[model samples]
Target: MKHTARPSLLLGIALLMCACSQQPDRPPKEAASPVVVAPAPQTPVDEVQRLLARAARSDPATANDLRLDAATELADRGDTVRARELLASIEGARLEGPQWVRHQVLLARIDIEDAAPATALARLDNPAMQTESAGITRATQVDLALVRADALQALNRPVESARERSLIQAWMSDEQQRRANARAILATLSQVDMGELGHEIGSATSDDWRGWLELASIWRDLRPGPNAQRAELQNWQQRNALIPSLEPAYRELAPEILERIKQPRRIALLLPLGGAAGAGAHAVLHGYLAEHYRQLQAGESAPPFAVIDTTSTEGGFPAAYNAAVSDGAELVIGPLLKEDLQAFAGNLELQVPTIALNFDNENPLALPKLYQFGLDAGDEVAQLAREADNRNLHRTLLLADASPRARRQVEDFNKQWRARNGVVLDTLYLGDLNDYRVQLERTLLVAQSRERSDMLARTLGFKFESEPRRRQDLDFAVLLADPVAARSVRPLLSFLYAGDLPLWATSESNAAVAGNRSDQDLEALRFIDMPWFSSAEATLRRSIQAAGYSGAIERLVALGVDASRLQSRVGLLTWLNEAGLGGATGELSLDTQGRIHRRGQWYVFADGTASPEKARPETPDPSSTEGGTAWQPQEQAPQTRDAPPRITP
Candidate 1:
């Protein structure tokens, strides 16, 4: 396996690196345990050798600089032992200035890597090192702060770790790197409980440290309404105007943040109310109005919005959009169809910011002011691939109903899975539930087991019974079918012998929670669906049901609610990439393609109801490696040719 081979490759390079340089005739100070070196490519080992050879022929100062470079390379490769050896050699030469700062920082880094966080902290706290490092290059200062932060984090001191990163943000030359550092500081602070965070803010010693903690507190407080949250953020920014390092990021993000909470002057909704899509459009309208009213009840200003039925209007999409703009509409949120979106995409006179209700994944277009938001089922296949990869389920079998949409999903999942270097052991398209046994038997090689028994019987004096075995090379199965079809297939899989095998599905297979006993047929099925069905939104679901909306249309209502909320914050998500806005539909984010993606929650069917899947442990058992087929027999092979209805294919 590549995973096991990787460490050996890095260790071989470390051995090669040791041979290239002269080792001081002294033992390495013993570590509590071996440093768990990160695997690296072979390129850096060659570079380290060249630097050391150059150092051998240089003057004392130049040689020490070369040695420092060599040590940095080794450290990056996770060759901590050899890296420390090189640093020790340089320290013996009495290095000074920027070189001395780099040497001390690197020694502390090695100490941390060797699990000696206390020693690392002591070395970095050397008052003499700090005074000398002050006049060093800005880059070196950032490096020293980063080393100290790592030491603090290793010691479980998150508050001090965040403080060290906060202190060096202004010294970073690259704007992008500085932004990343700020994000890291917030991330570290997020680990501290709110109680501890509040206590630290009250007792903070440095102004900059206190300012960062305050900003983090404002962001983490989710109880406040949108307006209240924005007001607090603006107030905090005004109070910390003198904090130079935090100002640039705030300035860059302010426009988007303000836009997020600000309501448009006039809004328009374009829906096909008279066409075949009228029912679906009305469901979406219900959801949109629900959120609009919810926001008003929370003391936010309500902007008047006009609904233009594209089906009843002249010139369809163009007429509806022009009418909205002519009436001074500041934002438009509609044209809920692929053809309508194409009309907007082709119209050269489009100027107002618009959010299309659907995306044309095949023919994506990115105009300056156009954004796409929708509940795209195709996106779920991509998510499924990622989930499968995360579970180490590489060798997979796909089973789906024979439909064009199912075919597209299979193709899509295959593309994503193969990109992750996963192998597709088999794919079976189901035409009828009655034939699943035949299809699965063929795919899982169950028929081969039967034939082997037949052949053995032919050679022997008498026939004996043996259980038919399913192929064990598949790690898991992907079920792409509707609830009705899944219910049938799931039980059939158990009958065929794979009841214990893991099965995965997407929202399509998720059925209404009507407490029907038949729902028990989906036991053990793990699937991803919107948070709308999660218990956290029990009240919201009750409200929707009170309005006489349920089943498939409920998802559209949730989509409509998200569309309403996203209209004002699309700009925010666009500028701050990867920053997701929590929406009723899911965690809403925008991809570079100008299409909004939703990441939903995972649930498992149990006791005739779906519940949130249990969170996976931070560290999984190494013996239970993911990927490849290794099925441990759950029961001994039966003496008869029959096995419980099988899960072979």
Candidate 2:
């Protein structure tokens, strides 16, 4: 009975437990829904501002960093005032390493923007903020160095600026970065005076630095073509083998610096031997042959040469070129006419190098080894414009003949003069030498002055004894006239009461030979011509005459002689214009467009003869003098001569 009662109690207990467990499991409390709060969107400025506000509450150093970053952004956004205020709020004393550098660099940038280059330089001169510092990144160092270089440049310390730029290269590990820095330094050094630059290069403390500076200097001055540049680089390597630090830089530049130009073994001559340009072509040929013979007499080996006539009706230019090529000619020179040059423009599949004697009016297709050599009138006028600007002659009068050639000269002169900020007071085109008085009156506004004088006289009821004066605004006169017209026009200018005004003329204004009577009228006329024509050396004159070349053809003869000598050195001319080939024609340089430019000697008609003019002193800086009158004529012997007759083109 006790067991049965115990069992019933156990069952009752189990039932009670079941009832407690089954009493509807109260729904488990739902897990609290995650409070997903979406973050609010913010702009760059707002985010930076928030960062600044948070940093200020936590870390002072972090706050300063945020302030600097915000300042840079503000400055970039053209809010410089706010940028400066933010920058000023940063406690600079707490910054270190790259942060300190950033602080100083930002200040320097602001100073530079304010035109305080000296202040900018001072800020960047801290020794602690070094590029070699492990805490600073290479990119940051380069950027800092660039800003310093710019500050130096703005201060007119280009040498110092170049040195600063060189620092960037030293820190650069990337080849492209090094090359870009080197180019920047070279470009800066190019604008510095050669003498000053040489001094700066010589003063370098390290052999490596000196080597780099020298390389840059050579590159800046010579601007050598691929072949010439390779030669120069090779020469540099030979001389600078001791500079251990420069090897990597040089090796990296080898590909860009090394290219080869084929040496011509045989050459063919082309000329208009029987046409309007026949005389000029013959003179050139004679000169060329004379040079070749001269070289042979000097025990030098001469290249094999052949002649092809472009004027021959039997075979044209193409046939001549083909025949020359077939004969193993590696080079050809000729086609001394614009039409001939234009005709050959379409023939781009030239087998070998060919130099044309004339240039097409339009830009021609750039074929391999096709060059143009001619006495370009446009070059002369451009040079004249430079001379005028150098002398500070701001206002000029242009008097040219009515011919097409003269008109072209005037147009080129006008374009060049205006390019230099010069003012063209007036331009006069004269049809006849006899009409000089009328043209001068109109151009000089003398007739208008005279008319005013008559009106004044009528109003006053009396005529003044003094004649009406010419306009005083003209600082100089450029006369593009033939010798005949120049002879007549020069004296006419004096009679027109303009003798006191300075006059400049082109080579065409002077005669190769003139009588004393004609020379008397050409006194004070300054012109430019080839050295072969104006050389005072009696031996040179005798040699030229002995060669049977004179007058208008003398220049062409000189051109031919230069062409022959330059055959082997044409690559040099293409790159190094400042180091020109000292030719009989003049200092000759070949431009990138394949045109030869000759810088001629200046001369003045004196004592019934033309004499080489002494080089004038360097013109004073316009800002250094009152009224900017830097040009003053040197006293010259008074002489005159008749102008030579015009040559038909």
Candidate 3:
């Protein structure tokens, strides 16, 4: 919540215009001292004038009291400059109790308005204000807390601001004000990263703080759909029954979500069901239907689904999409290819709300109703670049295997890194397994260091021994490789004395085996990948695998699962810009351009196990790579699949 002053000068102008005719040439001195013209002042200008007049005629101590009232009136009117000046004229040490607390609060309010949150917080945190806090009125207490929260928010301390808001929530008497305050708390908590919020929940000592954090975490989780989110909400309520301050906000969620849960009279999956892309299309179809069936099992309402095969139609996506709309599909969830999405970019508007399965890699024209949600490699690169920037890793080294996809990823990272003014000291493409060490040594400056050491020994005319040192200017390295290449290259870098350098990688480098001793070679390497790989989502992965969906293609299945889950809640993502929908592929959030960005879970390989970064370690077997390795899907499923039924034009 925030407060602002209006045009008090205009109020003064109106007062002068009305009173000019009533005044005599020589208005009496007593009149000059001013009487209460009316029982209540007409506006903030009148109130401030009346209080200042009374202060002029009162004793020094009482005059200071009236000045405080005048300052508050000025602040309420958004005349903070005048409010601050009036407040400064009074001796702060002379005030006590409620007046003293109010004095500090008003000063902090002015500081906040001046864009100095630290100064505002410092004034509010003063010991003298706390000493007299007990004597402050309920309204004053709320004001104190509100200002403190605002300062904290301005300083980017979202969790602490949320806590402060929660503290004074009950003190708010107006029902509307209380509800707004609760929303303010939620909005602030939403600004926090989901991963950070999870950690905060674990360490939170206050029941109130933990409840708010948990609620936010629940909202950010990758659930299957609105039904799953609502279920999680119910679970949160069951877990935290005692903290009722946020009940109004929690109660407010059900109706809004329930409305979304009832939306999209029908959903259409437009895919190339009988062509080269048939298998992937069928996987998507299966995953979407899986979520639909799962919701049906839970007795939740879901829109009827219709499938239209783009490949069977002569006109392709345009014809298939028309068919879906002709069948009363309120929301269309496919045309699952980049080329199909290119058709969307050509249109000025889409007939129905469309969630395209693939993103147009070329410069895409913005469409009002087109929402792109797919497993985009660019999203991971952007996230990693941001993570590296956040860690202050300015100077970077890039290493990638010789592959077309790896080349594209490297180019994307360079663009993102350069956009941030980050320096890429060197970039190397590893061509052969035999040349891995040589490539690393040359790019890392290890060979150069060894040459320099040997040259110095020869100049000394005696054998002087010194170990070679790699370049120390680099802050981190980006490795673009698969698990196999990473396994070989990571250990070699360490042996070459560049082991201490932090490595940031993409999901491609993540191995399928968990806690495999062979993974010991990948220890401490950080990578970002789909939530499907995370152990936390093992149940969801198992459910998909149980349905005969496995291997690399499972990623597409996960994409389809998210697409189904996202159909109803797209509005939620749009409404709350910071809100994220949890999905099998990643934590999904929407951008203003109608592009959905995925933030994958971060993992660090530790002693042969790829565990969630900074989270508690899971026990690992000390045996071989095969021992204690959790069963994940192989690169390819065991059997060949049959073609799904074709959709005729």
lDDT of each candidate versus the true structure: 0.70, 0.63, 0.72
What is the alpha-carbon RMSD of candidate 3 to the true structure? 14.9
- Which ranges of candidate 2 are over 4 A from the true structure? 1-263, 362-365, 418-421, 432-434, 447-468, 514-517, 534-541, 576-582, 586-593, 616-649
Rank by TM-score, descending? Answer: 3, 1, 2
* Candidate 1 vs candidate 3, TM-score winner: 3
Residue-wise C-alpha lDDT for candidate 1, range 21-116, written one tens digit per residue: 222332323322212222334556588778877877887678777888888888777788888866765554646566766776788788887877
Any idea what lDDT model 1 has?
Answer: 0.70
What is the lDDT for 565 in model 2? 67
- Which regions of candidate 3 deviate over 4 angstroms? 1-158, 172-177, 191-207, 217-244, 250-253, 347-349, 402-422, 432-439, 442-467, 511-520, 546-549, 618-649
Each model's backbone clash number: 9, 8, 5
Candidate 3, clashing residue pairs? 5-77, 5-78, 221-582, 222-582, 222-583
Q: Candidate 3's residue-wise lDDT over 513-586, tens digit each?
A: 54567777776778998777776668767788888887667888888878877787777676447665667788
Order of models, best lDDT first: 3, 1, 2
Best by TM-score: 3
